[model samples]
Target: MRHFLRPTVALLFAALALLTHRAHPAEHAVVITTTSTLGAAAQAVGGDSVSVETILPPGSCPGHFDLEPAQVRRLLACELFLRHDFQSFLDGRLLANGVARDRIAALPAAGGLCVPDTFVALGRAAAEALAVRLPGETEALRTRAEALAHEAQTRGNTLLARTARLRGKPVAGALHQAAFLRWLGLDVRCVLPGGDDPTPGAVSRALTEIRATGALAIVGNVPSGRRLPSTLASRGPPLVMFDNFPPSPRACRLLGHARPQRRPPARRAPRIAPCRTRSSPSPTSPSATPAGHCWTTSRLRSHAAVSPPCSAPTAPVRPHCCACSTANSHPPPAPAVSSAPIRPHSTGAAARRGVAESA
Candidate 1:
């Protein structure tokens, strides 16, 4: 009777445990990231271990984004939130919208200059925080983050190594990227915005520095176009517009590869104003054109003409001239003018004259 009671009690305990297990199932962590940059890294690290959602699309300023009802719902459901400088980003938006503060996690903010080094650093932090939230994914999350970091660092060093040729070449760039420019081995001489908005004092200082450093290349932010010093505009340094931010975090890897156009050697071919010849070719003949300066010069030589009139800059200057052999070009060649040799009064000269005369 005691043995029977023991078996019955054990069976009842097993049944109760099975019922409790069925009542609660494990849930995947829901992650919400504010920016695409952080969201991309989170996704790379989280893999399938966590469900990640992004709030801001690339290129949207945080101040401009107002949360919609659907987005707010998505945010409230998330178990974790990642943002660069989350305090300023979220403020009380999530809390006021009914999200518990405990679930939100702020990793260290990686600043501007979206090079691989910056991303790699942020990835590790994001992965670590995520591991804490989803203990079951600790190993996978940490491993993925480290692997990402390692690969990025490797790619960064390789990029730096490849850019060794740019070392010591002085440049003036957007204030935010001065350090990064130097890191890539560029010599940063003067920064733009010059502590000055085209102010006289700023202009004076910038010009002086430009002279001092011989900085012929001015790197400007792509977003802030044509804002260079007006005084320096027509005759200033070659303004190099740099796109600091790519469309997405995944594209951030392309940083540092942008380069300013190098002034072509002093012998760069002069720009040719597009011009069409006054004449057109016949149906049976394929028309040919001469190179710009060469064509102009050759025509001028033949015309013994005045300076080529400056052709009105046609809208969308097209290649009005196809490069062709001067032989096939317009203005057909002058027929050869041959003269018979003069006959000499004496012996050998007469023979030569006879040969020339074909007699």
Candidate 2:
């Protein structure tokens, strides 16, 4: 039975797996992108017409990313590839693997994606490129691109207006964050030399510039690594990090409105019943023991074999007992045991004692 059960279960699982695979077949053409920004843009424009996948991890820096065999396979299988100009790895390594130039789309923008104008331009460019490959959804893609661009512009304007008072405030930051900070209307005092790890001389120079300019904040690029010289941060101002790549094109809509963290519900204290004794009839009875008095060990052991007292409301009164006190007047004695008979010892001195005696 056990042997048959194992094979039967395996067959059932295999059938379930087959049904699941057939239930949802691959429907959309795969689109591969070097960074999340490209993937997001493609998703915004392409909609359900295409499936977008990013080669680079969301938290990784483009310069630091190393391509794997799986990523190469993905690029080879994808119908379209999207990338930015700064991603040199594609040119040196990835594109060399028989991936044609016609399939690739580059988003070359002078300003950061966070800037309204640049964002709109990127969306429009992405729409145009994607519409060429996915012709059936051209009108829908164009409409979505226009809507996305409009949203970005409106939100960017509102954010800019809110921070208008900080238009000319001096700020030190990474080169990558300069465009976004400038778009937000801050005066970029000095650009940090390196991405994550800068040389000692560069850090000293940046620190000197920050101190001289009296920069109020240091903005860092999230993808490039949100780290700066300790001396610069300590002596200068607060370090603020801005992400270069959003998780999705629509992700910018969530900016400024931080999702409130959900806290766990408060726990309740357990209820404890009041202790009672055999003498107590009720909590309020005059003859009952005081409130904290409890049944002792001896009291519990003595009444273990005996029935509950008549004083207890649940216990029935005996026929002979007229009063409840008579039931508890005397406790029953413990059971006695008989000992074995003593035998006479065979030794000479032990015989006189009539029992075995130790020397």
* Estimated TM-score for each candidate: 0.54, 0.61
Task: Give the C-alpha miss distance for residue 90 in model 2, angstroms.
Answer: 0.9
At residue 27, what lDDT does model 2 achieve? 30
What are the per-model numbers of colliding residue pairs? Answer: 0, 0
Name the 10 consecutive residues with the lowest summed lDDT in model 2: 298-307
- Clash pairs, candidate 2, are none
lDDT by residue for model 2 (100-199), tens: 7777877777776555566556667877887777776678778877765655555545555545677888888678768766766778988877745556
Give the poorly placed runs of model 1, Cα more than 4 Å off.
Answer: 1-30, 61-70, 86-89, 110-112, 194-212, 222-235, 249-359
lDDT of each: 0.46, 0.49
Error of 2 at 282 (Å): 66
Give per-residue CA lDDT, model 1, range 1-359, as digits (tens).
Answer: 99999999999999999987644322346677765456556655666555555564322333334566676677676668787764455648878878877777776645543455566666677778787777777888777776666555654565455456667887776675565566666788877763225667766767777778877566544333333533443456654333332222221112111111112234543321222233322211111100111111210110000012223321221111111111112322221111222222222443344233421
Model 1: how far is 292 from its true place, Å? Answer: 41
In lDDT terms, which candidate is top? Answer: 2
Q: Residue 231 lDDT in model 2?
A: 46
